[model samples]
Every structure is written in structure tokens, then in C-alpha cells.
Target: MLKNLGTARSIFLVAGFALVMGLLGPMPAGADENCREVSLPDGSVKIICQDDGGDEGSGGPGGGGSGGGERTCEFNESEIACSSEFGVWDGRCYARVASPQPPKSTPVWEGNDDGVILECNPPGCVGGPAPCPDRSFYWSPTAPAAPGPSAEELAQRAVAAMNLTMGEIGSTPPASTSDPNAVGTIGLPIWLWIADRAENTVGPITREESDGGLTVAATGTLERTEWTLTSASGATVGAITCDGPNAAGTPYDGRNSAEPSPTCGFGADLNSSPGSLTLTGTAHWVVEWQGGGQSGQITVPPQSNSTQVRIGELQALLRN
Candidate 1:
């Protein structure tokens, strides 16, 4: 049942054959057209060759079927297993990209699988998978790929570097205005100061690739904060500050309190009830990052904390 197949080169070997002992190595070199190799059910290798290259029982060329019967053939592996012998595939191993250039190779599929990818190039076709056609779906397998995964990884690192968390915010108002609860007369000014910041807890976010692994580093700083003050008294229009002041100076105007803040302060006429006025600071943190040959910045949602204040009128003494 041997047929004359053209000189095909790459060889794909299945694993089970190696485990068995009875199977012999490839047949001697001078096999005629009637010669063919077969693996018996017991894992034995045999070559049946005709005295002359004949069409005795060959279905067609290498079809290996008898009595005009047509045996089906198909490809199975999705890729060329890098370690496979240069030639057609035998459907059992993973495909790998061949390297070192100009290595043209042809694939000979041996199964009911048709997903194999084959390539042909130079130096007598000894290596590598073929290049994918243009305008097609391209997936990265250690090949030249666009900035997709790397970009995403860099973005995540930037956020962690900023480390804009709820626990990082604390107050540093003037000493006299430091009281969580304070009573001020009409026409009086309440001073404010920039809240104290916790030292650098996180660093800028960046990406690094080494030893076949990717690592992301994080570090960031706050750019600016948006603040608003709400009053419970007759004043509906509360004071808002967009200006970021470094020093806790409030003109100190004519107030008796120490270090009254002009930037981060609120003045109220009078609250009808207790604990009605509130001063809330919302910090809009901006984090910037660049690494892994890419750079970008992201803004997180506003994180805020509030302080309660009470307003009352001062009683004048009668000098009778």
C-alpha cells in the first residue's frame, strides 16, 4: 500500500512512539517508490516496499487507501511548533516562530485539523513562520506589537503612584481658628490655611521590563484642589476659593484671633441652630506618569473632608 510522495522535508513526530520499544528507526536510505513507513497498533515501525515503484494498492500517490478508496487529510496545529523538524506538521505539538531569517519551510499536515499556520522563506526553507497578511487580525506572540498591554499597565501604575486616598487629608487651619467649633461676631473674618499634607507615601508610576517580566512603579503629586464653604445662616452665598495659597495668611485684617486665613476661611452672620455651618474641602488630585517608552496623566475623583462651625453676635457692655 505504498505510494510515491514528492520529496517533502519537515518531519513532525508524535510523542507516544518514543515511549514504546518495539518501533524501529526510519527505514534504510534506498527505499523505492513502493516503500512506505507505518506505525503498527503495537507501536512497531515497518516499511513495506515494492521491488519496483508500482501502483499496486496505493489509492493515489500517498493517500494510502486501497481499492480506489479516498482517505481524508487535514491540518490540526494552529502554529508551527518551533522545535518541529522543517517540513509538514504531524498535528501533536505547539507551533513556534522560527528565527534567524530567510528560513523557508513548507507544512505537511497529517490529520483532521486545519488550523495550522505555515511559512516559506530563504536559505533553502529551513526556519520560521510566515508573515501574516496585511489588514488582518494580528495578535502578539513575542513579535513586534503596538502599545496595547504596555500602555494599560503604565496607566495603572500612575494611579497607584498618585496614592490619592481618603486618609491622606488633614487640616492645618490658623491656631485661633483651629477649634473645630468657633463662634464669631458679624463683620468678623474667619481665617483658613492649606491643610497639611502627609509626606510622600507613593512615588510616580512607571513600567519596567526585564528578565522576561514586567514591573510597574508608582509615585505622584497633587496639582490643585477645589474647595467650597456652605453656610446655615442667612448667608446663602458661601465663599469659595480656587486660589491655592502656600502660606496661612488671611490679611490678619482686624481679627483678635491668631493667623486668620483669607483663602481657606468662612464668615457667617448667625446660625439659627447648633452645628449648621460647614466648611468642606474637596481635593482634586492630578497624577502624572511616564514610563516604558510611554507617558500620560490621569485625574482621580475629588476626595473631601468637612469642618463644622457656629456663628453668634457679641454682646456689648454698657458703661453706665
Candidate 2:
């Protein structure tokens, strides 16, 4: 019968059919009796291992056999367990762990050919030591709020400084003739008042801006005039009255026609001592006129001709 059974099993295996073993006899004691059947949709058959009577098969303690075992094992998508040796170091059990590297060192400064040692502390450092201090040291402290000068104070200081630099009391350059038909040159003298030696004499004068910043009015008496002409032969001629306030009609006005009639005031001596004249002071002038039956004031801007005079030069002039 065993020979016939072996032959029959061979035929079924070759025919790709399922075969059962020991179907008519009892299995031996201590032998696994549990059987597992696996069937493919294509009619293929599989024989799985099993456990019997507390016998532990290749499956682990729960009898859900591990590796090649007879038990059906269910795996959860959310729960995971690592198996390979490499997976342990890769943080498969938890989140990945990172290893840290060392920090970089600070750079040092070198001078010329020699290398100097420098010390550093939190915030900043104090170069060298007390006795032999470093060539250079710097401290960066919070700055204090700055104070500002008042407008009047600033203006006063500027005016005083200017006076000290320019000369006190000078005359402006003579103006050229106005009429082409005029025979002789027509000119006017400008007298400057300087209070101190430290003051600057005049500001800049420019015609390009307006009338070349020129003042044509003479402050002294044009009438009752006196002239002592000396000839080339060294002969003194009698004083003659070439022209006066009576001669020239009211001192020909050179002011702009659009402007009001400008008047020239009497020349008055400025009371200044040797010391007072040397001190700095501001120079100012005003123009007043009556025109169109209306009287008003016009302030002339300080020109280059207006300046601060220095005290030292005035003192020297007094000595001369």
C-alpha cells in the first residue's frame, strides 16, 4: 500500500493537484497535527507549518509563527518595529538624532612685520596692560544729546567774528561815467564805517546780482565844495569851485528808476576809541526816500564791500 501511495502522490504532484497525506491513519504523538491551507485563485496549493499540543514551532511565543510559521499575523499601519541592525542607528525606534560639530575661532589682527597678541573678553577688550599700554585704544560709549545754539546768539557771534577779520572804516571804488555824451568821468565815493579792528570791512559786491552792489551817493557836502589842484609843474593853483550842491542839480540820482528817490545823509564822525575801534562790530546801512508823495524805508542788503575789520591792523594804523 505504501508503494502504491508513493506512486499516487507522484502522479498528483506532476498533475498540479492537491494531495493529502495520512488521511486514513492517526498522526504520531508529539507531532504537529494542525494544518494550514493556502489556495491561489489559479488553483495552486500551499502547505504551511503548524503548532500542536503546546509545541512551539518556528513561530514565536504567541503562536503567530514568525518567519516560516503556521499562524496568521496582522500588522498595523501606525505601529512599526525595526528588524535590521542598521535600522537601530537610523532612529527607526524614534525620531532621528543629530551629532554636533565644534565652533570656529575668532580672527586676529596683525601689524607690519610683527605679529602681536590680543586678548578678548565679553562685550569688548582692553588692549595690552596698564604699565605698557597698547599703541591704540578705543571706547564706544553711548553718546550724550547735543545742545544747539539760539538764532540771535549765533547771529551775534558770526557778526562779531566777521568784524574782527575785516578793517574798520574804508571807501568803496568810484563808479564809472553814466552818459556816453559826458566829457569828464562821473564818479561817486562810498565811505564805510568800521567800529573795531576785529570786524570784517565789507561783504562781497557783485553787479551780476544787481547794480553790481554799488552805492553812488556821497555822504559829505557836495555843495560849498573846495578844490586845491596841483599842476605837473609843482605849482599850486587857486582853489576853485568846480561844482557844488548849488551847481549840480540835487546831486544826480543814480538809483534805479523803479526805486524810490534815495537821499544821502550828512557825514557824521563815529565816536570810537582806540580800543573800541579795535573791537569787532557789525556794519549796517539804510536807504530812505520820498517819492509819489509817499515816504518809506528800503534796506540795502550787506554787500561784499561790507566786511569785518581786525583790531590788530587798526592799532597799527593808530601808531602810524
Query: Among these predicted structures, which one has the highest lDDT?
Result: 1
* TM values, all candidates: 0.42, 0.15
- lDDT, candidate 2, residue 288? 37
TM-score of candidate 1 against the unseen true structure: 0.42
Where model 1 places Cα greater than 4 Å from the true spot, the runs are 1-148, 166-181, 194-196, 200-219, 233-236, 242-259, 266-275
lDDT of 1 by residue, 1-320 (tens): 12322222112133445644237654543555555543322334445444434332211111111121212112221112112233222121122333332212321222213333223221123344434221011111232211123433555754654456422222322222466454644445455544443433221233332211223344445444444445666454454444434322233355455433545554443122333456555555555554433456667676666665555556789998
**Index of the highest-TM-score prediction:** 1
lDDT of each: 0.38, 0.24
Model 1: ten consecutive residues of lowest lDDT: 132-141
- Candidate 2 per-residue lDDT over residues 1-320, each given as its tens digit: 99999999999796653324445343333354454333322233333333233322221112122232112222222212221111111111111111121111212111222322211111111233322211111111211111122222233333333332223322111111222222211122222222232212222221110011111211111122222222334343222222332211123245432222122211221211111111112223233332111233334333322222111112224553
